[model samples]
Target: MAVIANAKVETLPEPWSGAIRSGRHQLITDKPESFGGQDQGLAPYDLICSGLISCTMITLRMYAQHKGIDLGAFQVEADFCTNKEGREWIERRVHFQSPPDEALQHKVLDICSKTPVTKTLLRSLEINTQLV
Candidate 1:
């Protein structure tokens, strides 16, 4: 199969610091100073959480458009946590500029929960990694 979107990440000179390249967009990521990395950008976990949040919003927007629903304006926030045992969890909150009808709101929430990224995270996806 052909690749859709491609990205590359490489470590910077600073420890635990790296940059990501996806198409025309570039972003830096780093551990906090407490973790011995310069407080440059978002940590890995933060980036994962952001991916979920971003994908959810995009999915919602597209769904709304397809359904001919007026979503108005909305925002999503995702908080991620990893316990000492390495168990991870994410909490997501959605806020709307103007509340929609109960039925439409429920539909939107259902769609958000079923976004590709959200489903992958919730269903314990297995990623096959290889060095090429």
Candidate 2:
């Protein structure tokens, strides 16, 4: 397995009061002002939660396909909370929309729990963070 120790990301301002990223691909992020965002560039917290969910789902899908157990094409909603201490602190919750058979569902969840990104967040989390 190839491990991405660090991914370098680039960001730029949108043409009209927004923000985006440019690389091999392009993405845009914006939110309403009520969420403490400038209403620009994906709200940072939402982006983080999305990362958690996407990686987990990727792993789960691959595993299920390999085992010949189709998860039946579902969506996962993921949200996370920052702990009392730091960014290194988090609570990841993934909700699968499709209700599959018990055995299939559990296996999908289990597969998510083992993805490299999930494992990194849970196990290899040692960082120097200072909250101002």
TM-score of each: 0.88, 0.64
Most lDDT-accurate candidate: 1
* Lowest-sum lDDT 10-residue window in model 1: 1-10
The residue-by-residue lDDT of candidate 1 on 42-71, one tens digit each, is: 998898899999999999999988989888
Q: What tens digits encode model 2's per-residue C-alpha lDDT throughout 1-132?
A: 564544333444533234444445445566556754456555656777778778877887788778886666666666565556765555655555667778776776677778777777677566675865
Error of 1 at 103 (Å): 1.1
What residue pairs clash in candidate 2, if any at all? 29-42
> Top TM-score: which candidate number?
1
